[model samples]
Target chain A: MRAIVLAEGAPYAPAPLSASHPLPPPSPDTTLVTIHAAALNHRDVWIRKGLYPKIVPGSVLGSDCAGTDESGRRVLINPSVNWASDPRAPENPDIYGMLGLLPLPGTLAEQVRVPSRLVHPVPSHLDFVHAAALPLAGLTAYRAVVTRGEVKPGDKVLITGIGGGVAIFALQFARALGATVIVTSSDDSKIARAVKLGAAAGINYKNLDWRKAIGAHGPFDVVIDGAGGEGVAVYIKSMRPGGNLVVYGSTAGSEVPLQIPIVFLKNINIKGSTMGNEAEFKSMLELVSKHEIVPIVSSIVDGLERAEGAFDMMKNGNQFGKLVIRVHEKHHL
Target chain B: MRAIVLAEGAPYAPAPLSASHPLPPPSPDTTLVTIHAAALNHRDVWIRKGLYPKIVPGSVLGSDCAGTDESGRRVLINPSVNWASDPRAPENPDIYGMLGLLPLPGTLAEQVRVPSRLVHPVPSHLDFVHAAALPLAGLTAYRAVVTRGEVKPGDKVLITGIGGGVAIFALQFARALGATVIVTSSDDSKIARAVKLGAAAGINYKNLDWRKAIGAHGPFDVVIDGAGGEGVAVYIKSMRPGGNLVVYGSTAGSEVPLQIPIVFLKNINIKGSTMGNEAEFKSMLELVSKHEIVPIVSSIVDGLERAEGAFDMMKNGNQFGKLVIRVHEKHHL
Candidate 1:
């Protein structure tokens, strides 16, 4: 089986393509998936740079994928694995792992074995490439916006770092829920592009008083942000009283000064969300199917050999949406 | 009406007691209560020290009060006023006001006029002093523990600053909900008292590795905290996955280094909760009545003439519970 294997070297070492990786056999509770398309995420970049610990050399490296099973049914793999049975939270959150994150083999390989329950049929309207983009980022956005943020009809929603896959998905999900979506980005061009994608408004965070600049668009009912930094305090103030700030990442570095009085006095909720439970994953797919929401795929590479280019693009932070790898032809069986 | 008023001086200047203040007149929508007892809060102390802005001169400076109404019914007043209609949050949080803070007259006077809705019948089990202690601190604890934290049976709860009024109430409330309560305080004697009040365990946060000291008692399902400081980052790591850390104050200073990855990765929720809504207040009173919970009042001054002494006790951080001013005899009608 062909796979994108992490090279054996120091952090930031380039991973190379290999066609001689051994194929994983299906366990009794697991089924074989022939991946047609897979997508790159910040996780992959971080892993390549050795920022994420316990790097397993020669391990397959993609968390999001869309492919076919023995029954030739279109399915997208749920990357978040080993979640506890509880609906409210994972039973052992500390030990929870994702596919392609060390112990679990990712979807970059042409064939992978996974628990049968983790596979869900792709929306009929989406092709494998777009379907591949929806697993990790989509579920994350689903939990942040729809479940945690509780974006409702007529509610104003703000999503920070507008060009990232999760932020883009959050915008789409909030808009699909009939919310007025607003976005913020350092790049005005990306903000403009996001506005074209049904965002009600956009703000360039480069301005000293971006919060005041976007005052007319707020106070937002929900804010989906991944950046947890000193600036987050400003976002808290921008929210309506009792608004939800659903955070999933900290690209801007951790350690934010939180004005405690403002949070409690305003009845604001700062919910820390991540890759959701299986139920939320199903709901995300259902919403996608109902709305025919195609993930924003900014670039597509031809094969595993070009996977490094996708990773480099993500490292550069220039891509506006998901960067996908065409593992096989759509007609492959 | 006798009351305590902030004197014209620098921050931390002593406020003076006055017996010649005019009594508050009851409006059609308001009721006049003859105060039998009123408790001093950290808020009262802070305001008297000029830490709070816009301190109104000649204003009575107490928030928690228990007294008799025109009908001679025993009552306690909830000082949070003019909340938004929404049950989840206040309408305009920035402008939300509390009695005795500024602009609003407090309960330090012999008589106070408040909207009828803010008054609730005191449980028969409570004396006026104990009842007064329950209104402000009790409501804050109820909101933090029962409402925001969502503590459940068998859940392990952590309340920081165990000796404070809010912390003590949270300990009691969590225990009432069948939770295993743990506390953190600088004073070991306070920890001993908390354990006597049904706390499962206690940790002295003054120790550098307090997290390790309480490792066996955690990862807590809910952590009701009022102190937000550098130590909060460590507490975040101590929470179980999907645990709630309900924060109400920032006595340890407002800025804290929040490790964002730990928050999202653990799926921990840091909720900011303050005085609860009217519905939550009613529920709190019902719970108090059901459990026959008596607020812990550490000291009782003979009359409003010694109200400044109560404030001084709080400012000195020596009181373990509430400091009450006995305005009149408990049997006053």
Candidate 2:
């Protein structure tokens, strides 16, 4: 099988590809997926650059993909594996499960093995590339807005960094829930795109004080922050008393200085969410299927051989929505 | 009517006292409580020393008191008063209501008027001083642990600075809920007292790294933090994944420089809780009554004349529990 294997930690300019690798047979309760399309994540760039120390030298680096299994059913790979079994699962001892992070290999290859439970049947109406984009970023946004933020129909929601994958999803999700969505973006084009996507307002953070702009919105009930650092403090100040601030990523920076007195005085709640649980994933898929909400496919590269180009486009932030690598020929089962 | 009034804000050594002021008349549906005992809280000291800028000259400064109303019912005053007609009243506002920092007349005087709803029936077994101590500190602790923290039995709870009023109540409340209480204090005497009051473990923060010390017992399911400043970073690090860190006050100063990465990775929750609502107040009182939990009264000062002494003792941190002022003779009513 042809796979995009990380030979050594190097820049994207040095093409590193393994055309032939032995593919392992699927173990019991595991299905072997023939990758139809795999999406590029920022994590893929990080893993390939050796930014994450935990990644082994030869590890495949992708978490979102849509493919066909041994049974020839099209599905989206739920990349998040928990080695620790769900405490709620009746048959299992409390054992940890794994998603894409550890001992299990990632999705950026010709073929991958996953537990039957982690693969969900993709709706027949959805294409493989679009289905591949829904697992990681979609679930993350679902958990941030729906599960953690508890976004209500009339609630006012603020999505920071309008152009990012999760932010875009949050904007759509909040609007779909009947919330008034406000977005902040440094780029005017991105801000315009977000506005076109049903955002009530957009602030070009480069030109205006987003804090004052958000203040003019008069205190949002929920603030979903993808841009961390000092931006979080500004967003926190922009929240109404007893409002919630859900943080999933700190793309700007990690260390943020906070005013503890103000936080207590306002009685705010700060929650940190990562990815969604399996139940949340199913619910998100259901919402997408029911609403016919299509994931914006920025670009699709042909073949697993072009995976590096997809990674580069994502790393450069030139692509909007998600970028995918079509691993199999369209007519091939 | 006799009242403890600060003619001017100053240190307790030259404390001002005035007694010739007229008692406030009770308005519609209000109660005139003949103050039997008024507790000296840290707020009183802050108000007296002019640390609180809103406290005007001749302002009465006390938050907790228990006495007999005009109807002869034994009652405890809820100092957080808000006008019943205020738009925010639908939320069942507090006595002082949402304006927590404003200098409202306190409960230290021989005669005080409170809205009918702010006065709660006292348990017959509890004396005036004990009941007076339960309003501010007791309510704050209760909200931090039970209402916001949602502490459960068998959960490990951490209380910082156990000698203070809120910490003492938190220690008792967590213990009453069957949680394993771990307290941190700089004083050995306070540590000993906390253990006797039901703390499973006490760490002298002065002698050891509190985080390391707590790590031995951790990871704490709930951490009630009043000690702010950089110590909050340590406290946040001490919490278990998915645990809650409830902050009510920042005694050590409010600036908390934090690492946002740690928050997202650990999936922790940080909530700010103020003094509880009327429902929470009633619930706490019921718990206290059911458990026959008498507030630990450190000392009692006789007469309004000795109110200055009580204030000084509280300011100097010399009291183990609540420092209360007995405003009138036992038979005066």
Candidate 3:
């Protein structure tokens, strides 16, 4: 077994992973997955740079992967584990974390072991690469758009950071649910690409008055945002009374300054969402299957040895969709 | 008819309300009520000082009232009106506001008129002064604790700014619903008084480490807060995973700096609640009736001519519950 390990040092200038790491053993009630494809996420980049919390050395670093089980069934791995039965939160949240984070073995290796229940059959419409792209980002977007944000038919939905994996999935999911989708991105080309993917409109958020640009088309019913920072105030102003703003991640700083009076007076609801539960994971896959939606694979590098190339592309933040590593050939299993 | 008008001036500098202003007229589908008693909220203080939006010079300054309607029925007015049919928000949120704010005539007059639908029959257990104290604060608290906050039996609930009308009502509501209630106040005597009123514990927020005092007992299921400022960060830290922090007012300051990552990672929800809708007002009354809860009235001015006394007390923030203006004799109806 060969794996990519988070070598010591900052996230940038990392050539930490090695190809000859020893194979990890599978425990009872856990199945060994021969990973055919693995996807790189911003989380991976953050962990490698030591910017994220609880970074452990020698831990295989990936949260999204697809492969085959002992039963020879194609499966996608849900990286979120140890969730509480309560749909609202994870069990032992202080210690709760996703795969590739500290303590958990990620799917960056030739073979990885995970709890049996965390495995779901890949949607028939997807291959190993697309399935690998769907779990972490797809489930997060599903919870933000459908479960918490409560987007409905004809609802006006806005997804920020349009080129990111979660934002892309949220756009597609909202469209599938009959919502009129709008997107925002820093890059005009990425915005254009999102519009081509069926968004009703797109805005380059780099503009000083980006919110006003979106406001021209909004008073939106649902806003799926991952950037939690000073810019959240502008989004708040754009919301209609009683609108829902669902925040899934904070890539931009975490301390957000809010206008408290406007929030209550306008009857706006700000919901903070995260990785989502097992049930949501299942629902996300079902939606992908029913819609026959093919996830966008922005760039692909063949062989487990080339995983760093995918990481580099993700770090650049220019990719429009998932960056994948073909760990093993699809027929190898 | 006689009423108090918001004269142009700084809110705390002078006696802005004059008692000899002309009376207001009732609208269509509305009924005139000879007000027996009226209550003052912090909103009145803000409007008087011109700190709130949409301040009109001649508008009557009150929202909570108990009086006699046509046919001599004893009733209390529900200040929230023209709520949108959507369960999530008000119909015309921009214009929809409580009584006595601008646009709507408040209940601080000798005679007041309101939409007939906003009137609820006073519970048999209450008199004019207590009934008048219950509507604005009661409805806001009920919406925060039961409807939006989703407090359940045996839940540990935290109510901040316990001396205020809405916070007091929230304490009573959560306690009545079988929740273990804790309260915070800057005044030690007010905290002692809240504990006497059935709060399980109390902390004087004046202490620099007040959150540390409460944290020993918390990981609270629900926290009902009125002060929104730097202290909000401490409250966020005190919450357990999946906890709900319901904010109804921002008397401390409107610009609240929040720790964004903690909110999402803990799966905590920060909900902005205000005066409830028509349905929730009705539900609040039903709960009041079911529990036979007697609203606490902290001070009572003798006549509508002395309404300024109630306003002054609210500005001082010394009262532990509602401050009322006895507008007319109870038997005058």
Best by TM-score: 1
Fraction of the real A/B interface contacts present in each candidate? Answer: 0.74, 0.65, 0.68
Model 2, A236-293: lDDT tens digits are 7888777889888888888888888777777788888777667777888887887777
List DockQ for all candidates.
Answer: 0.71, 0.51, 0.70
i-RMS, every candidate? 1.2, 4.1, 1.2
lDDT of 1 by residue, A113-134 (tens): 8888998998999999999999
Candidate 3 CAPRI level: medium
lDDT of 3 by residue, A200-299 (tens): 9888878988868987978889899998876688788888877888888788879888888888777677888888888888888889999999999898
How well is each residue in B254-303 modelled by candidate 2, as lDDT tens digits?
A: 88786776676666778887776667777788888887788888988888
Report how far residue B255 has shifted in candidate 3, in Å. 1.3
Pitting candidate 1 against candidate 3, the one with the higher DockQ is: 1
Best by DockQ: 1
Clash pairs for candidate 3: A11-A49, A84-A91, B11-B49, B84-B90, B84-B91
Clashing residue pairs in candidate 1, if any? none
Determine the backbone clash count of candidate 2: 18
What is the lDDT, from 0 to 100, of the residue A136 in candidate 2?
Answer: 86
- Residue A232 error for model 1, in Å? 1.3
